[model samples]
Target: MIETYSIWNLHGEQVDHASSSNAPRVDNVKPIVDPNDQVMGIIQDVFPFASTNINQEGEDDVPTPIDSAEFEQYKKLLKNVNQELYPGCESFSVLTAIVELMHGKIKYRMSNLCFDYFLGVFKRMLPTDNCLPKDHKHAQKMLHGLGLGYEKIHACKNNCMLFYKEHETLDTCPICNESRFKMTSQNRTTKIPQKVMRYLPLKPRLQRLYMSTHTATDMR
Candidate 1:
């Protein structure tokens, strides 16, 4: 049989029309992979005339090494993070401290969930350190002018459905028959929601661009 190949995207969707005349562009296209899909090899076009490792005599093909002095700067940042560790510390603070402390000392294991979790802790920590007015307060103390609003919606504990529109007054999840909250000591269920989702408004987010001096210039 003749040799055959397939192209795919990050979502594991087959790319039927990914042909390109440029070899460099083809190399930049990453193959999409699905968890269950078997991968034979990466899908990219290679030009017969293209050269990769033909180092010219007078020209340097290797990249310059990182400066040894720059490592000290990173070391100092870690010391600062290590100084802020405390009991009952938020995950964000703990992770930030660990990352800063381990900078250059070890490989950083950064991920989306890790970063987002700590970011929330960092934001919460910032507001507690100052006594600025509620309207003037921001986690970074830099975006005091920025404003955002979110709506909290009641959601099922099992995540089977959302109590929206016709189900606003629902006290129990229809599918699971689970109470909206636990029947604790003082009926705390009524005081606090069990599962809540914040709906960030898009209109205000768009408007914030024009309001912020840092982004206003770019928006214009």
Candidate 2:
């Protein structure tokens, strides 16, 4: 891995800069389904946008970047796993609940019946007695397989513009009367961000080409 430093020639003063993807967790992205175009399609179907400042008229109506054909490719990829596997059920809620029980702190003691029920249902889902993939582990595997996801930048709450290189200094949203921060206390009183724009990163693509077993050393 490459390393970087910020302390300079004169006074050793340094400004810190860091970034990360702000997309929702895989579970929250759309429960039990693969984090592919299908999730976008389903979400957009359920909650169709009632006009948006972010796009030209009716542009937001078509949500996913891929057309119908590419989506069918993904749908076909799952047929071997379950011939009857419908579009809505890629993963299992049993796994989701089991994962939640494992990660979260419990108030009740050793013999929780609901927890036992979750484990029982989860065990039943396995084809054999030996093994099953954990939800979070599978999520990590999917994330790594995707190479990387998208990072986000703050946006105007009114959708006037994105607060990027040119508009990073604005305090309030210029288009609307809304303040950039929340109206409540705590971080809201400070200069906290309210909205964001998620976009895919290019650096991970370059890194993946270098790291990929199939592509490394074949620069062209």
Candidate 3:
């Protein structure tokens, strides 16, 4: 059976005359998705792609060998994460806790100082053997190592353009003539971007999809 899709403008009006090759320059074309089609998968809960080779120990049964440097780095991280903080609790558990709390803080628009204070409390209350970081900066380092982080890019506050590529070093927005950074206090020297955009690296994430046998087969 043949299925058709509609092109919609920004105002939610259907553009009957909008063709892929002949659509007007001013009219933006957004293709309406088909609910029955796999063109876009069903929206559901966020989950890690399941692997058939996952062992009873909740680890990947098939270990992909890496270079000595990478192996050592993984070994170090494993050591830090596997440490028994207090009886049944491993240091990795604390890391997950920090991750969940940070996720909630961002999701709920909680205060940064509040989150840092909570982390400080965890550090003080938990066993000294626990590998939980002291603050968001250290937590970010651990998350980045685990491939769960994003890159920050500076952008124009008015959304005129991104401060990327050839525009990377510019101090002001060429289109709007607006300052790229906000005015800071005389005592402070750090130049903070007027606005920032978070970007997730695609390479590692794409590789991870193929690691799952089902996802790999589906992709093919």
Candidate 4:
């Protein structure tokens, strides 16, 4: 990796800067999905503005910068960030609990069952004064309320392709032709994919980055 440095001749102070090779790079371009536009169609359905680039007149296709008014709308949507988990709960808010739980899960590599158990225990300990979720389901619902819900996209077990758009009703992988649903004696009627992928929407998350004053300033 290449590196660059600046030195003050008089004071003998030196500062180092990363060269192009060493500097961190972020991919800003939209990802290319299925050639047939199936995945892109699904994404556009969820977020109508996701694929919007050109204006109503179909002018140049480019990213439309968010103005101050648009930013205010996003702020209004996320105004409940400081909402308390329960009435009179000052130590922990809904957002705080969610963040802490997520951090704990990642830091300790906690499983879903383990997370559920801990949440249940915390709920019992706090009694009626706390609104800690009873399990992962409730926590997920809370996230949904805050516009952060994840999408469950069924996928082929053989890593062939996702079941979406034109392939939405297909029972098998288009490429491998493998059975999509696993064999189950108990729930034979209920069709379940052999593998599932969780997709978290990025629009609200991007809006969240501009919610805070410091972060918003940096973003600008």
Candidate 5:
């Protein structure tokens, strides 16, 4: 029976056990275990190359983090605005207040849904007096321009589904069989309905609000 021994070796370190004649003629014998307690094979010795250790020699450079106080203030402002705008009320004052708050805050980016809600609030808050503020007039002008564009695009082609480019030719109207035709920018010639133009202001007003908010820090 041959005397056997088990030993643990560190990674990449060579172990030699064949120095003596009585140590068993094992050449490059490496540790191997089987399901049964048996020696399985011999393996070549391998060593890993040494590398320099990196030393971090300075104070940890980390940013001064935002404290809970600032975060709480933001949350409180957001909550207050949400409360003022909620329940879907038709009050321009509340909507304007919300818009003002959102404009002041960097977190809230304007969107189409927000614009629609703002417009709804404005419509509800529109005064019986014909006179309007300069801002309101500007907003209205932007809306009217968009409305006119929509109308022009919708007019030349009977159906909104028809591609804008297809409207340029008098060959045939995709929506209706009318041979009469007119062309506008980008080869668009379809005639959009007047009714659809009425809603164009809704998008433009929202766009104006967003633009105004981003362009100026102060709402004035």
Candidate 6:
């Protein structure tokens, strides 16, 4: 017989065991699974955009520039993980949850600012598991609109919120109504204080969504 292990959710609220006998435990947390109760592998740690780039000795390097290829790869990786680990989660909910995990307490403010940067473009981008095709014309348009073309955006360790240029202005989100939100930035980086921002708080809806999606998957 194969040995099994228990997996923990993001909140550390509950534990689910692995379906496969071969799953390994790194940190306490494991990846989400499907309804059929199979081990989908664990959620890979969210790759920080800042770590991808290297600076010359004594030279400062900002976050790696956002390119279409990298963005598409990020999306596919996210989608695959979602399908295996968090099956029932709406794409938006999953993305929001990941963003929340990335940003932690500052999700709201980051959401507001990011919402503004794309003129609310994120609203439409939501509910998508990063599976959009690379050649999709809309993707290019969206990237261009966000000023993401050839520019780098970094996620703050505090809340997973993304930052482009420091001290920027936000207008409107193309996807959601502007009246539903408010925005701000909390700079937390000591070295690049101006360039960094924190993550936002997880809203009640998101919390519920996360719980509902992972509760059952934990059992297998």
Best by TM-score: 3
- For model 3, give the RMSD to the true fold: 16.5
Worst 10 contiguous positions by lDDT, candidate 4 = 34-43
Ranking by TM-score: 3, 4, 1, 2, 5, 6
* Sliding window of 10 residues with minimal summed lDDT for model 3: 38-47
Query: Sorted by lDDT, highest first, which candidate order results?
Result: 4, 3, 2, 1, 6, 5
Over 1-220, each residue of candidate 3 has an lDDT whose tens digit, in order, gives 2245444455677666635557447767788743222101211001222113478998777644446655554544444444444556722344455555677889988787887888889789987776668887777665444444578989999999999999999999999999999999988889889899999999877765665444777767
Residue ranges of candidate 1 with Cα displaced over 4 Å: 1-145, 186-189, 216-220
The better candidate by lDDT, 2 or 6, is 2
TM-score of each: 0.33, 0.32, 0.53, 0.51, 0.19, 0.16
- Cα lDDT of model 5 by residue, 68-169, tens digit: 654454344333323423344333223234334344332566564565566556546754442222243343332221122333333324443432365544
Q: Comparing candidate 1 with candidate 6, which one achieves the higher lDDT?
A: 1
Query: Over the stretch 1-220, how does candidate 6's per-residue lDDT look in tens digits?
Result: 2244344344555544464346666687676644222212222212235133456785656755667765675665445435422335453333233332334325545453443444335434644444332322333342232111233444333433444344133332223323212343456433332233334544633433343434535534
Give one digit per residue, the lDDT tens place, for model 2 in 119-203. 5566577555323333434423322312246877888787888877877777777777567666667645456678988988888
The predicted structure with the larger TM-score, 1 or 2, is 1
Alpha-carbon lDDT, every model: 0.46, 0.48, 0.63, 0.65, 0.37, 0.38
What are the runs in model 6 whose C-alpha is more than 4 Å off?
1-74, 77-85, 91-93, 107-220
Candidate 4, residue 153: the lDDT equals 88
How much does each candidate deviate from the true structure in C-alpha RMSD?
20.9, 29.0, 16.5, 14.4, 26.8, 23.9
Best by lDDT: 4
Per-residue C-alpha lDDT of model 1 across residues 129-154, encoded as one tens digit per residue = 42221221222232111124579888
True-structure lDDT of candidate 4 = 0.65
| Candidate 2 structure, TM-score to reference | 0.32
Q: What count of clashes does model 3 give?
A: 0
Error of 2 at 79 (Å): 30
Model 3, runs deviating above 4 Å: 1-72, 87-111, 127-130, 185-189, 212-220
